[model samples]
Target: MISCSPAEPVVPKEGGGNRERGAAPRWILADFDDTLAPGDSHAGLLRYILRRRIWPLLLLPVIALGGVVYLVPSQRRRGISLIWWAITLGLSPLGWRKLVRAYCHTRPGLFREAHRLLEEEGHRCWVLSASPRALVRAQLALQRPANLPYRTIGSRMHYRLGGLMPRFYCHGQHKLLPEICALDTELALSDSLHDLPLLGLGEQGWLINPTPARLEKARARLPHLMVKNWQL
Candidate 1:
């Protein structure tokens, strides 16, 4: 099972603690998939659908088409996510939760050292992901240790006419929307170069488990980012 080391206490500085009262909170913007979990929630969900035979093999073509759509530029990824949501619209909320919880239970080794280091430093952490908000929230709720506190921001889903629908796709550059951009982000962590825009929002960044080519590209684009190897 996934577990966390004991958190070190945050010592207040002299003179009744450091910094002026009402200072802007420092936050660590972290990616959910790969950064926290061993696998992607979206991919896990797809695997569940396949294993359960919830849909016929005929639907695979449509799913493949959605994947193609995701590769297109100019906000098309949002459309692709929406398509996937529509395809899975028949699943009840309780059923969805069960699937997510089962997936979370099987994935161990979450809360990596990098995560511990950030939290130990007393930074408020927020998970930022392109994955559907409900799935991300469910996984975090199951996997996160009680001692660690965190908030999550991800693509939202809306229930309309008794079906779940995509309300937002928080991926790529969209991860740095104005609401998120306004935060006093001290650091950001991510595995994919797609998160470069989000990484740029933070004063410092860490690229986790990136390919050598991707690392070189990120270094060229973000010279100040620290690269770290993380086994997932």
Candidate 2:
């Protein structure tokens, strides 16, 4: 596991970060897996469920189906959902959410920078992920009793194919966020190159989990990028 803290970046003086209470919320976006946290949530959940139950093995065929379906570029979300449905056969809506919450509580380590952003005042930061919304919300709940505030947008659970599956996942670079479409983004943070479009929305952007060579490449293009170290 890697231990990391946020690198302080220069924020423009007019908006975002530690602003007045009751003021209109400043928007920010954060990626979860491989950005704020280290790994893939869906994969993690599968392993978690597998260790506790025999069901995942019984549903291996479904995962195979998902694997085949995942080959198509546009149907990836649907493919992933099929795999999830198989892994989560026994859980109802509430049960699934409780499991997600429990999984998040058990795995509490996140990049220190993630906490700093949450604690800052006046920003209505939204943690965005391709992971399910429940997974995102559960992790945010772990920061409760303190922190500035938080919101989440991820793959939403909708009843489809006779089970609760992710209906709309935030995947590609141009994924639309209707909630913040009208507002000005103060900052954007993500690890993937696909998110450059989203990063452009913010006045400032932080690319998380960059390799040293990759960071150098980015700095060559944009010299002012901030830095933080991680202990692997």
Candidate 3:
């Protein structure tokens, strides 16, 4: 293996040492949400809109309409409940995801660092997640790192009639192992126990904040698996 430390100082210069060593090439695989961003992007967006926009614009309006409905008699209020329900059902999920993606531009520095390190080491990198592609793509666009490879594999929704029609959640062998095999990644890094299939594909694997029970369990399941902490 090539030395990864800095080279020795030329002519033994004072207070100086050799140039820093470079690392070997390895593929990087990451999970989104808690692994990259500080928190759940999907939830964060919903909470922000609920607290800032939806509650006030929707709940307040509905409540005000309800109070007036009692005074205005039941005839005019026939469609008011239906209208309120429709508004709530429509605006809630839509507004929340939009706002969350906007607010979730701030991803974790640790994950970014890991990404950079693996990339600089000339490893292929990819994100494997269960999040929808729209959300993941939005976040990835914002967190574009110069040194890292660009690839995202995640859930996607099929739309019809101007609304969500089908939901796809990327998990199990469908999500993890396939990507690992396709990329031929030598190493995989992840924080969740569900990433076992992906980790098994790697020549070596690193788990972040792995619980003791999970570690033991993983080792038992993957006898040849190599485990290490993800410093970045």
Candidate 4:
């Protein structure tokens, strides 16, 4: 799976490395997937579907429905029909969230250094993930020790019969800023090109999971921001 770590061009910083030091510490805005938790949660869900041998059968009907819909007259091809079809036939919220929570629980840390900092420094840490809050909270409970000091700021959901439908998913360039605004955090951490909005909101932003290309790109843009290698 492709890494969600943001490239340098997107990160906004003065130069390179940490500028804030001493007792005046800053809050951290962190992305849950890839940045903090290693690996793709969505990919794990897909793997589960494949292992269960359920995807092929589950998708077939959806495809058939889509084909049938496409065959309908343009006037009948309403947005509500598509929404209803997705609600009725596509991925169920229960199954999807189960996969998501399971995957999140199993995720390894991408940036140990950053996590250590958050733990040691006692920063007001909040996980800003595209994932639902329940999923993040569950993973944190399962994977990280209860002693770990942090809270999660994530997407909300709505409960349905035997499932949960996502009301909104936090993503794209604009996603993290609102989280930062709501949380009032000064620092942020992420590992993706799409997290620039969140990164820019930080007084000090750290880019995790650096590659040769990504490192160079980040250096060119956010020179002051620290770029840490996750493997270390």
Using TM-score as the measure, the top candidate is: 1
RMSD of 1: 9.0
Model 2, backbone clash pairs (residues 3+ apart or across chains), number: 1
Candidate 2 Cα misplacement greater than 4 A, ranges: 1-25, 212-232
User: Is 1 or 4 the stronger prediction by TM-score?
Assistant: 1
The weakest ten consecutive residues by lDDT in model 4 span 75-84
Reference-based TM-score of each model: 0.80, 0.76, 0.58, 0.63
List the candidate numbers ranked by TM-score, top first.
1, 2, 4, 3
lDDT of each: 0.67, 0.66, 0.52, 0.57
Q: Which TM-score value belongs to model 1? A: 0.80
Give per-residue CA lDDT, model 4, range 126-201, as digits (tens).
6777665766667666655543446676656665443233455566443644335544346777887556557766
lDDT of 1 at 173: 70
Best by lDDT: 1
RMSD of each: 9.0, 7.3, 15.9, 8.1
lDDT of 1 by residue, 1-232 (tens): 1011112211111122344678977777888888766667776766665576555345667667767776776746655654555456577877767776776666664656744654474238878887887777776656545534366788787666554556777777777666666676677789888777777766778998888899998888777788877763
Residues 118-173, candidate 3: write the lDDT tens digits: 45652357777766566666776666544444577776644433333124455434
Model 2 per-residue lDDT tens digits across residues 27-66 = 7777777777776775787677666667578878888998
Give the RMSD in angstroms, all C-alphas superposed, for model 4.
Answer: 8.1
